[model samples]
Target: MSKLILVLNCGSSSLKGAVLNTENSEVLLSCLGEKLGLPDAYITFKVDGQKEKVDLSAQPDHTGAVGAMLDKLKAMGLDSQVGAIGHRVVSGGELYSDSVLINDDVIAAIEKCIPLAPLHNPANLLGIRAAQNIFEGLPNVAVFDTAFHQTMPEHAYTYAVPRKLYRDLGLRRYGFHGTSYRFVSEEAARFLGKDVHNLRLVVAHLGNGASVAAIKNGQSVDTSMGITPLEGLVMGTRAGDIDASVYEFLADNLNLSVKEITNLLNKQSGLLGISELSSDCRTIEEESLNGHAGAILALEIFSYRLAKYVASMAVAAGGIDALVFTGGIGENSDIIRTKVLNYCEFLGMNVDAEANLAARFGNAGIITTADSKVVSVVIPTNEELMIAQDTARLSGL
Candidate 1:
């Protein structure tokens, strides 16, 4: 069988597909279909490094999107070599610890997880069924985002709530961004010339939706996000790490329902709520440099919380051998990295300003002085490639 894996990340209205060759880590083709079920639905394709955008008719859905992309592949004569279809499913919810071949039973298990990831899994199921229809006779694999953190022990993922909630409802921490963490941690170890099994690290996966993970001996020990993505990090719009009583308090004071309060925290809060500006970190950083009070405060809080979480996560790393940064803000923002590492004096991280600036924009390099106790490195994340690798392995391609 060919080593090509078609990795698909299906959002509620967007689908991102990539054809990657695991042997050489080359992406042969990639595409994005967005605004499905809307009148202005469109899809973009990139084959041989050139991108083309195609506008769709009114009310295009997942099946339509898949068929369109498959049509492109067939035209390019690349469809026949696709070995398997890999899917990115969020919130495996203790049902899966690693990537698995997709079958009827696997589909059912994924359906059971829809309640846990209502915003994501349904769309994922739609994509799976669409792929099964359009890419008939090809093997399908499911690579879950929660798989890597499955190694987390009970003490690390447990809640302070009642036993009934834990046993009956299965409410506990199940961190997201496991794929990015897995990819970057191994890459960081490779860069350090150390086997991952011997390295202790804390990684901050900072982006619009962000989280921190503590990996010791190359296994996840603890993570910041709990039960849902809304639980950790000051994200673009999410008010992470808030008190549970805020729901009830808001319901009383603002005359809002529990659902409305939850929506506000997830959609209206975070840096946007605090700054009343925009959710984009770049914008916030620019405004802060211009001396905007709210933006300045937002940046300060974002950096401080990240530093505090890194310090807390270092305990799980046993002590820190290195602190690796990935994702959009983590990879490209020298300002953010400098602010965060400056607060890590207790952890022995002395950020080298010149090296920190040089590491931005797809450049992977050490951002700390050679003599610093904990080495700091910036590495960009490749989650789709990770998904493709898992799919290729699980599908026996």
Candidate 2:
């Protein structure tokens, strides 16, 4: 039997799992449990190029979901093949700078970060605990989404708020999507034929949750998302970079509580709120093409704000050698890419319209003119693979 590394990412209402060959990082099996803890919950698994879905009438929680997934793996005679388990943790909160072996102390630390990543860390902890229980003797590793940004300098991560809030409460910039950034930045360096330690790059990870990072000499120098994932560029449901006064205005005029306002910003804003249609960018783009005013405005705002953040990241890097677009919208949306690059023309980055459109569906290549001052490329991010590799290494596989 082949040694496999199981990579698990647990969201608020879902759990995604992937089994990868430890040696070459090829996915051997994948599954997703959606609507977890709800009556209509279901588990979808794909193996041997075949897909199957099973409904859970009783509504399994994360633990039950993991049990179901394990049963399937065991039936395939792959249970003992798992060498290590990697969990995608959303926040490390200065407690961890890199992937670490899980233990009682690690669980406590992850619990401490729940306030920093209210919606994500708790779900992550649940998955971690469940994996620990199921895969008792196997090594478990945590690959944090905020770990890569720990290299950011104090000035880059510190907010203008009172120092007590930061010192006492651990309130500071803890940028998310770091695993994706780490993978793509290294990949970008490889594509440019330059050593990662010597290249300066700007990465735009635009998806449901979006952020731009200024990577200088293989380390994150600065990033747009701060304190939380809600402070960066416009995202699917997040109202990013809003003025602080809006919270006050909403409280006074709209009579919204802090929690209510936070829910509004994180769950109901962004493309969904502005477009008043859907949070999915593809939907908005289609609507924009069909002359929907709200969708047009949403796309315009997303692109324009993204372009500005990319430019700002270049400044943070002192000069960018390359610009990388990754994540769902970044990798596939030609319309969004073109709109963003149009605004970045002043930075000597010219987009090749044909190349941009051609580089979709996991095809990664240069989308900029040969003589362009800055190289622009699209690279699909593989956070799962990155997590597996990290787990394999940490587990001594």
Candidate 3:
């Protein structure tokens, strides 16, 4: 049987799985299980470009979801072909700097970093355990989103706070979206027909959870996200880079606890808070076109902050040879792209209006003029493929 690698990215309520041929990176099957443990739980799978949906009569948890996914693969005679499993672990802490084989010690280390990623590590552990149970004796690899950023310099990852805090605890910047950044940076270099090691690039991963990174010679030099995913560019619902004093201010005036304030920043702020409407950028754009004041202001803040971060990342790279955009919004939203590029005109990044509009629908193309100093291109990210490749290599597939 041909060897295949299984990639699993688990969330608190969702699980995304993909089976890819180890030799070539061709996806054999991909599926998503959503609303797990809820009445509306459903699993959608696509194979050979055909999609099918299976609705669970009873709410299924993560274990059940993985079982259903594996059962479907077995029905297609792919169970025995799956030689390894790759899991997307959100936070690996300082202990793990690269993808590693999952074992009891690895699981214990992941559990130890729970406080660093209270929301994601547990769900990742759950997926890892479930896959281990179902596919006994098979190699399972843990790919961390924070692993790529481990290359950052001490000054870049360190906070301005007390030294003891960072020494005693890992209170330092650990950027996220590293998997996407790594894939897109390499793709950007390939698209530019240049060696990544000789390039200085800035990558903006704009999605529900957005961030920017400075890639110096193909390695992450600095990134927008800090110790948590909540820090950095304003996201769908996250209040990024807020004034520290605001916490105490809200506590005194709104009589909110620290936990409540954290919740507000993480779930109730950003575009949603500014516009007092939906967090979806498409909806905000439509409202802005219809003369919604709040939406207009929200978009302005989002684009301005993004451009500011892009410029800052360029500084971190010393200079930028190319600026790449990827992720849901960065890959699709021409309006947002135009607005951000307009602010970056000072950096000699000129956008070809037609090309900007043309680079949509999963098309990867340059959106900047030929003579522009900074190359701007949109490349859709495939984090699953990256995970599969890592898993295959580490597991000796």
Candidate 4:
């Protein structure tokens, strides 16, 4: 039988899936089911070089989304012979050192972690449950977003909080976006033709939600994100690393509720709040070019912070050989990359401006000058494919 693996990444109100033909190493079908305002949603699939968007207005949640995707796959001549199902689980605590098959105990442990990622874990669970229901008796794998960072030591992962709270509430740093980091780290190793463990590298996963990680000997030594995704580099909507006292001040002075504060931090902040414009990097870039002060400031702060964090991570790794940029903004925004590299000149980093600008959204080599001590690279991350591969390995396919 042909081996195929289905990878699912679930958000608060949406589900993203990729059906991979593991034998051929191709994505057979990829779809996103969005649930914004309406009770139901629509799924858009990329199949056979054609884009097909289907309205599954009858199904309300992720289970419905999975069913809809399955039906569409069947219509396209795909069947129920899937070899495995992989879920991008957001938090794995310290229990999971690597990808593992999902059993009832795993599900329960994931449930216990919901408080750590209230907005994400439920959706992930729904996806897992839905896939389990749709593909009965099939091997399901849980690929954690925190698994790759399990290598971080106490000096890097610990918070300054009291020891009791740290022990009781599990309040130490549990860096997110591990899947992206893992994929690109391995890819960087492949591109350099060196064992990943031999390199001292830092990876920046700069998307709508962004973070930076320091990898030493192929193990995550440190990362910017903390106990939640809300900490790290500035994001499209998230406030990232803000003063903790702000929450208390707002609650006491402005009489704001916790939910309102959360909404503001998670939705109304970041580039959107600072720029008073769109949260998208493309829009921010356009507006900055037009001399929008806030937009320009937002971009400046974002780049400056990224550069500063990359330098700090270098300290943890002792020194850096390569700095990799990935995700949406990191891969596509040449202006941002240029700004970041310029700020890192003190660390012996220099980007070939012409080359940096030309490498946008393409798989290219080093944008940094050969004479520079630190080489800068742009690598696009493929978390779905990584999950599929992990699923295949876990299923013994």
- The Cα local distance difference test for each model comes to 0.91, 0.92, 0.93, 0.89
Query: Which 10-residue window of candidate 4 scores lowest in summed lDDT?
Result: 35-44
- Candidate 4 lDDT over 1-397, as tens digits, reads 5878989999878889999977777888889889822665777888877988777777677888888877986897776667789999999888787999999999998999998888888889999999999877889999999999999999999988899988888889999999999989989988978799899999999999999999988989999999888888889998888899998999999899989998999999988888999899999999999999999999998999889899999998878989999998988999999999999998889889877987776565688998998889999898988999999998998
Model 1 backbone overlap count = 0
| Tens-digit lDDT track of model 2 for 1-397 | 5678999999988999999995676888899999987878888999988999977656478887788878888888889889999999999999988999998899999999999988999999889988988888899999998999999999889988899999999888989899999999999888878998998899999999999999999999899998789998989999999988898999999999999999999999999999999999999999999999999999999999999998899888989898999999999999999998899998888899899999999999899998788889999999999999999899998
Provide the TM-score for each candidate, comma-separated. Answer: 0.97, 0.98, 0.97, 0.97
In candidate 2, clashing pairs total: 1
What is the Cα-based TM-score of model 2? 0.98
Q: By the lDDT metric, which is better: model 3 or model 4?
A: 3
Residue-level lDDT of model 1, residues 1-397, one tens digit each, is 3558888999999999888989888988899999988988999999777999988664388888888878887897888888899999997899999989999999999999887888999999999999999999888998888889999999889998897998998888899999999999999999989999999999999999989999999899999998889987899999999889998899889999988998999999988988899999999999999999999998888889889999989987788899999999999999999999999977899999999999988999999998898899998999999999888888888
Clash numbers, per candidate: 0, 1, 0, 0
Q: Candidate 1, TM-score vs. the true structure?
A: 0.97
* lDDT, residue 170, model 3: 90
- Model 3 stretches with alpha carbons more than 4 Å out: 57-59
